[model samples]
Target chain A: MGEAIVITSGKGGVGKTTTTANLGTALALAGKRVCLVDTDIGLRNLDVVMGLENRIIYDLVDVVQGRCTVQKALVKDKRFDDKLYLLPAAQTSDKTAVTPEQMKKLIHELKQDYDYILIDCPAGIEQGYRNAVAGADGAIVVTTPEVSAVRDADRIIGLLEKEENVRSPRLIINRIRGHMVKNGDMLDIDEIVMHLSIDLLGIIADDENVIKASNNGEPIVLDPNSKASIAYRNIARRILGESVPLQSLEEEQKGVFAKIKKFFGMR
Target chain B: MNRQKQQYVTIKGTKDGLTLHLDDTCSYHDLVMELEEKLSVNQTNEPDGPLVAVHLKVGNRYLTPEQEEEIRTLIRTKKNLVVESIDSNVITKEEALGWKRKTEIVSVSKIVRSGQILHVKGDLLLIGDVNPGGTVIAGGNIFILGALRGIAHAGYYGNKEAVIAASVMKPMQLRISDIMSRSPDYKSEERNEMECAYIDDNNQIVVDRLQLLTHLRPHLTRLERRL
Candidate 1:
């Protein structure tokens, strides 16, 4: 059976959804039959990010409540063809509408057909979080280098460690800026790993292309030239148990002039 | 008269004193009337008895000053009766004795998360880290095998000699009896040595290495004897 992994971060706006979209696409590019399930319920956005929002006639709630079959609710990504699928969350229903048992049953059904099931969990440690993690075999905790995000990530890691099925949830340090870390203005990957005490899965640098790709309803992993795309591919490889060395973020500096511009609050 | 109404005001004689148990659900008017009737019956039964102090036990109810005064006046009306003191019947004298005799240590092996409060009647021993925003309160001593990062209050019921011992003593607040000490801001270090905190001779909370705590062991032993 395929593994179900939950992508969660306890705090909001810390790149959980973005990480889910990119990682799902990266795994699909690697020729794995992947299913991206959005467990955010009322705040669903995964379908929009995958450019499958318009094609969604049935959703996760419809499948769970038996209004539609799991196969009917699964929306195949146009770009990935049949390789990647999106099970969009119900935008009108809240998290309470779905129970953890229902999510477990849904994930069990998806696991039979897909090689990888990635659950995009909603922010916060409530019912939505429980539903997302109910059937996952592993968890990927995403966090920014900021103190608040790291603190919440620590709590999430602590929770995942306590789960019966989750075995040592991996950490993803997102939104890293090499110049900020070099200037001692932001926490580096090493410092964050030391504080959180979790194995580092991968690090994605702060790239404007990520935002542009999201706005265009395209995952950055599809754009092979983007820095985030390469980083996401490395993460997917690492997840598949490949020993890939980390990319050197320090080597791609923006020069002294750029630093001076950044210092003066200019983009 | 209802048997339940009659049982509302129970009069019992003990070796130390006489106890008057007032029912928790009885109205104030009914309590006063029942108490007066009981006292009059006792007075007529023993006409030439000496004055006896009566302890009023109101079960889990706070008595107003006016109600207390009314009860005291009713007791004084009987020439051979006097108001000793007002106490709650929620916990009986035997129950208090049982608590004092309790030397059991409660042990917990899970991480105490935020917004969780663990209160133990006797000594408490925890085998996991107490996270921030959590609280650990004990009537006796507290011993943490892991990091004590949360608030720990030992000797919450006023046992001045109770101590708090932890492997890593970086708690937000350490309290012993009435004295409380906030943890000082310090750099994180591998604290291989355990520490013990207790109220010193100067009436201030002081933390010392576990090895040095032997000097205070005799005092703690004496306090246990008193208990």
Candidate 2:
């Protein structure tokens, strides 16, 4: 059976949906059959992130509530050539429309076909969180370096640890600004990991291109030269048990002298 | 002593001290006479014994100041006797209830998450961090062994004497009784030391280092001794 991973963070706007989209696309590009499941229900955004919003005729709630079959609800990504699919969440219905048992049953069926099923969990440790984590075998908790975000991430990690199926959730430090870290204004990765005490899966630095890619309905992982895309591809490899060295975020912006030298072709 | 005089006054020994039960139905003269007789006999029997503090219980009756003074004078006549307290039936009942409330303590060892609230009916002893957006309300004092970045309302039930102590006390808002104080916007680098919050003489919430808490309430050391 394929591994079902839940992407969750207790606080909102910390890039849980973005991570799910990029990681799912990257995994598919690595020759894996990936199905991205959006479990946010009323606050669905994964469909828009994947550029599959128009193709979602039947959603997760419809499949769970017996309104449609899983195959009918699954939307194939045209860019991936049948390797990537998305099961979108219902825009009208809330999280309570589907129970944990129904989610577990749906995931069980999907596991028979897909290589990886990534659930985009909603924020907060409430009913939505329970439903998203109910069927997952592993979890990825994303968080920013801010104190509020780290505090909520700690709570999400605590909850994930208590689940029988979720094997020790990994941490993804998102939106890290190296300049701020160097200036002692922002928390470092070591400090966050020390506070949370979870395994580090990947770190995606703050990149303006990520926002542009999201606005254009494309994950950064689709672009080879984007720094954030490179980070997401590395994260996908790390998830597949590859020993990939972390990319240094500090060197992305070249100094003015180096830019001038390159412009003048000085050798 | 006559059977009626014996019924008017009764003396009992306890672990902490002695208890004197005075009946309101009897005449004041008889009550004083019987109490003096018991004290004289008790002093003669144990002349060199350790001093035993006496607590008087006047059932369903209010004693005039003169009558109360007479009882105190009679008990003090003996060298081995000392009056600890004078209580009426109403005060004794209230004290029993107060003791029951004071003995209750809620101990939680889990980290209080965001959007989670914990309300304790008595003193609270927490061994985990209270994250931002979390709230802890205690009727009495609150003791936290970890960082307190959330709202902690000690003395929730209007107990101004209650205190809140934490190892790393950078709370979003600290409330003692009805007074509330929010932490400054800038973070302090010296959070390694423990800090305590309590009501000051002006009835405002004041936070100081844990060691200096004794200066605010001198009886805190005595209470810690009992613990």
Candidate 3:
């Protein structure tokens, strides 16, 4: 049986897609056979982020409706085709086209061939969210350090716990600005972790390289030097059952102060 | 005469327990007579006395609340009686109100997500974090063993004495009774230090390190202490 992981966050626009893309790439790069299925039916972005938008002849809805087999709809990623695949969401239809039982059946069919199945959950705690998480063995909630994002993460965690079969969802704190945290101007790592109270996966420091990489349809995990890339790599490693220690706040603050003195002229 | 009265009862298993729906339209006294008659038949079938119970059903006929109470009192005295809704003669506001008085305490084992409000009347204990988008309003003291990082209101019914305690206390908003504080300016180490928040002498909610409350309390004695 393959392990299915759902990447979800209650609030929208908090890096669920970005985390899915980068983590899938990172996991595939680690040689695990991974299939990333986008459950956001109407607004399909996982395909675009994975740079396989042009190759999608069939989508998740077709597979769920039995119009096409899951193997026929599966899009092989050229860069990591041997290890990573994409089950793109249908842009024409809404989330109602797929039921939770159908999604579970689809995942179960893929289980014999694949080792890891990652479902990119839709935003909000509606029917779509339920369908995406229904078949997953576990879940990872993505959130930013902002109060709004953290609140949504908490709510998603609540929903996951209430689900009959879901294991406790873990947390991913993304797009964090280590500098603002040092100045006490923004919510810090401890605060976010304390608030969400899920198992700490790892923290991804805010990096402009991630934006540039996304613009080129490349994931930040490809860049070995970027802090966010390293963090994502660590997260990918943790998913593989490796215990990796997280970077300390003091180390993060050092860069914050250095940037302030150099960029803002604070002596 | 008592043995004759016990003969009319009937029994069947239900989700709650065994139910006995009496013959329809029978008067309360007539239903009692039939219940006794049924019970005598059951007693003869099983010589080893299995505790048999009786219930009466009136098909859509509304009886007075007093009649329902009399039946309830009668059944409660007997062993293993479950007067289900189908058999219940009538329901009164007073009886419904009694069920509402029963309180429950639920421990949130994990993060309470955003857009969800947990309104608990009794002591609320949370094992996990309270994220920012979530709100926890309790009528009693709130204890977050992990973290209280969301919007929290303790002693919600204007009770001045309620305390909100958390291991990591970086809440987005904190309120105790009428006092509301929403400045994200406080800075403390990320160590597992406990914090307690309450209103102080000047009527403003004050949050201090739980360990330093001894030194801080003497200076703010005018502030009321909520137990």
Candidate 4:
């Protein structure tokens, strides 16, 4: 059976959904069959980010509640050509609609068919979070390079470590402003990793295009050249047992020569 | 002199109070008989005189609560004789075990993460870091061999004399018994060296170098020795 991994963060607005979408897309791009399960029942956004919102018919609640079969609830993403599927959460129901035991059984059923199952956990340590972590073989904790995000990540790691089923969670420091980190204005990836004291999978830089892609209903990993997209791909490769060195996060200021070079290439 | 030594009961009046001595080696039956007879002789000259307090000393003998109460009832018959205290040289096995637990040191090696609490009945020796929002409480003392970035309440069971020592002492809050010292009030020392906290003579928890623990509570290291 394939392994299931849960992506979780204790606090809200820390790029958990974004990380989940990008990692799911990246893993699928590597020719591995991947199923992305969204456990954020009421606050469902994974389908929209994956651009599969319109195709969702039977959701996670319907499958868990035995209203529909697991196959009927899965939404195929034509972009990956049968490699990627999105099991969207129900937008009408809350987290209590599903329990951890039911989720564990459902995930176990899905694990038989997929190469990798990535469960997108909710923002808090509530029923949704527990349900997402119930059957996972591993966990990934996402956070930004800020005090609040790091503190919340610490709390989530504390909870995840207590789980007997889930493996030790790794760290992903997202939204790293290169210039800000260079100027000591923000917490660096090293500082965040050292503070959290977990293995660093990869670090995603603060790219505004990440927001643009999410708003446009596209996973950032589709754009392979972008900083955040490449970071996601690296983390995905690391998860697949490949050792990839971290990309440098210090984007320096444009010097006068670069400005003159840009003048020469006038549009 | 030999017959006096053989007697199971002895009563005397010192300069202050009357002392009642019970022979421990004699049979329980004989001891009770001699005690009753000795006090019965004094019951005749009783109520007319003033109340005289007596101290009962039972050497190397364990007395059950019921047997002690029986002795107290027998003393009550002598209206003039009042029992002040009962002293024994031996304690129950349960009490001895409790004393052992109170002095035992528990060694733990794990990251005390946020919102997690590690508490023990006796002294705690943690070999891992305590992240912020975590707590470690001990009935005796807390000794952390790693960083302490959280709250530590030593002497949780009202042991005001308990102490907290850490390799990296940056605790957000420190409590020794009822007294507490929070950040800003406590010098937020990010010092790398080891530091220990204890209630000083001023009744305030003070953080100082770890070596001072030997001077502050010299008896802390006196009970057990390691080669």
Candidate 5:
């Protein structure tokens, strides 16, 4: 069985789907068979970000309801042949369409065939979040450098701790701006780590390439040269039990190559 | 050890005092016999006679679900029983008898947060602050190393001899057994102090400085101290 990972943030719009898409692709790029499941249901977007939305004929609801086999509903990643698959969410259904037991069963089936399973959890701590995390071995809580986001992340950590299966949840601070943090305009990386008091997975700096990749319906990790892509890839490596040095968001912005990369991408 | 084992008695130590784990299956007479045997063993270990206190761990499985009140009553009369987790699942009679024997010492390792009501059976040793709106009800003593701003009921088994000790005692209310008391309007002069409360000779609960109040709350009175 493969390792099930849920990318969850208690508050809405914290880049959980983006992290899942990129991590899944990065893991596959590293030669591990990965399956990315979008458990957002009605608010599905992992398929769109991975450029596999149009190819989705069957969704997670279909597999859970016994309407289709698990393999038939899996959307293979076009960029990485036989390396990555996505269990796209159903657009027409709500979170209640799938039960935790069914979700566990689906992930159980994928565990033996895949090396990694990334579940893009829904915004709130609702049925979707529960279902997505039911069979997960670990979790990544994505949050922005904001008070409300950190607060909600704290709540999600508390809820996850109550579950007997969940281990210590890792933290990912997305959209971090070194300049803003330096000027005392935004919360710094250390502050978030201290407040959340959890293990830091990796941090994704504010980069326009993320938005660009999303707009282009592709995960940023495929670019390898993109800074956000590198960060997500590092996180993926860390998830696979590797100890990598966390690149300071400040140090990355000072380098000339970063400036040129940003200029070329118009970041 | 074998003689004591036959009596179905187990013993543990905590910051408050000793906690005795009793076999619920054992008859009341056998249970007391085991307690005496345990005390004798302790007497040989420490050269002190029954200096190690005893507390009972009742089997929640054998006790009816509705018998929580009865269990609580038993604890009060015995002035030592610590009611452990109420068994709500499929608990067999034999399993219930064995579970109580393997009870671990109670240790609360996190900050008792708001809206949390934790009823600890044994002595509760808090590693973090007991925040306001939180609660800790222990059948034995409760020792809070940090600020205690919540409701704490220690010696809940009518053990007026039990004590509530904290570094900072700013609790909204405090109770030991059936005796209940609250801070005077939250504006009283004795708001922040290392103090202990116990019942007086007149049977009224009184609070005094740890050094000055020779008699603790829920037990001895100021007059008794002089005596």
Candidate 6:
């Protein structure tokens, strides 16, 4: 049976959808049968990020409500060649449209066929988050280096640890600006992990291409040389029980003249 | 006369009023019957003078508040008698348990994460970090062996004498009883020593070094060594 892992951040605009899309694609790239379940309901965006917006006919609400078969609701990702599929969330319906019990049943049915089911959770810890976490065997708490995001992640982790089905949740620090961390401006990886006291799954550096690729309906993991893509692949390998070393981030420093200019307070 | 010699209810005169000693070995019904008979016999001596104050003493017998009230009502039924006090040598087991719960220290070893609150009846000895947005409340004192970056409310149940001590004493807010004091806004004070917060004589929450607790609350130490 497949394992269902929910990707959630208690605060909004923290790259939960991006992580879900890239991780699912990375797992698919590793030849694992991956199913991405979007549980955001009214504010679904996983389909758009995966470039499968036009393909979604029957959504998560339809499958759980018995309006359509699970096979009928699944949108296949042609890029992965039968390796990846997405169960989109219904844009018209709210979080109350689906119940946690129905979500659990639906995920249990999907687990029989897929190797991994990544549930893309909504922002708040309400019904949508509950439905996303209901069937999750494990969880991935995504957060940025910002204090607000970290605080919300801590709250979510506390909630996740109380779940009977979900195991110890792991952390993924996303959108880290390497230079700001080097300059001791932003919260670094070690500080956040120490504060949250959870096992660090992986960290993704902030790259311009991530936003650009998402804007074009393609996840960053499609580009092999993309830094964010490489990080996602490493995270996927770690999820597959591979001990790949975490990629250390080092910002591109300028020449001696730039350092002199920086000393003189030049931009 | 033999029954009078083995009386279960004894009354004695004092300068202020009279003291009624109820027999600890007798049943509740027998004690009530004898007391009623004795009071009725003395009814002729009453009503001519002012009300006689009566103090009921139950030796080695624990009486519930309701039972004590019943005895008071029995005495008050007479127009010349008024109950001044009800004294007992023993207490109910529930009261003993409640006292023990209020005085004993509860030890916990877990992270009090954000949005979570740990509450203990008496003193708390927490061995984990209180993350930001988390809270730890205790009826007695609070002693944290780890970082306290969140809120700590010692004496939450209105125990004005309670204190909160932490190893890394950097909390967003500290409350002792009704008084609250927020940590200084500056984050540059990085030298985190063992610190404690307690209510001062001026009715304010004061955060100071943990060492001050030795002089401030010397009675907190309950350890007695004979060896």
- lDDT-best of 2 and 3: 2
lDDT-best of 4 and 6: 6
TM-score of each: 0.69, 0.69, 0.64, 0.88, 0.60, 0.90
Model 2 TM: 0.69
Compute DockQ for each candidate against the true complex. 0.08, 0.20, 0.44, 0.63, 0.06, 0.78
Best by lDDT: 6
What CAPRI class is candidate 2?
incorrect
Q: Estimate the lDDT of model 6.
A: 0.92
Task: Rank by lDDT, highest first.
Answer: 6, 4, 2, 1, 3, 5
User: Per-residue CA lDDT of candidate 1, range A1-267, in tens?
Assistant: 899999999999989999999999999999999999999999998988887789999999999999989999999987886889999999999999999999999999899999999999999999999999998999999999997887688778767877898877899999998889989999888978765666899999999999999988999999999888999999999999997888778644388998898789886
How far does residue B28 in candidate 5 sit from its true spot (Å)?
Answer: 19
Weakest lDDT window of 10 consecutive positions for candidate 2 chain A: A249-258
Off by over 4 Å in 5: A251-267, B1-106, B111-124, B128-227
Best by DockQ: 6
Compose the digit string of candidate 4's lDDT tens values, residues B175-200.
99999998676445357789999999
DockQ of 1: 0.08
lDDT, candidate 2, at A96: 94
In the range A159-189, model 3's lDDT, one tens digit per residue, is 8888877788898888877678889888888
Model 4 clashing residue pairs (backbone):
none
Give the alpha carbon lDDT tens digit for every residue of A1-267 in model 5. Answer: 678888899899989988888888899889999999999899899989888888999999988888999889999976888999999999998999989988888888899999888889999888988998898888888999997787678778767877777788999999998889989899988967865668999999999989999989988888879888889889888988899999776645557887998889854
In model 3, the runs with Cα more than 4 Å from the true position are A247-267, B1-113, B117-227
State the weakest 10-residue window (summed lDDT) of model 5 chain B: B218-227
User: lDDT by residue for model 5 over B42-151, one digit each (tens)?
Assistant: 43333333333334455532545455565445443343334443334347666654454222236777756445677776557787666656788887667787777778
Clashes of 1: 0
Question: What TM-score results for chain B in every one of the models?
Answer: 0.55, 0.57, 0.47, 0.77, 0.47, 0.83
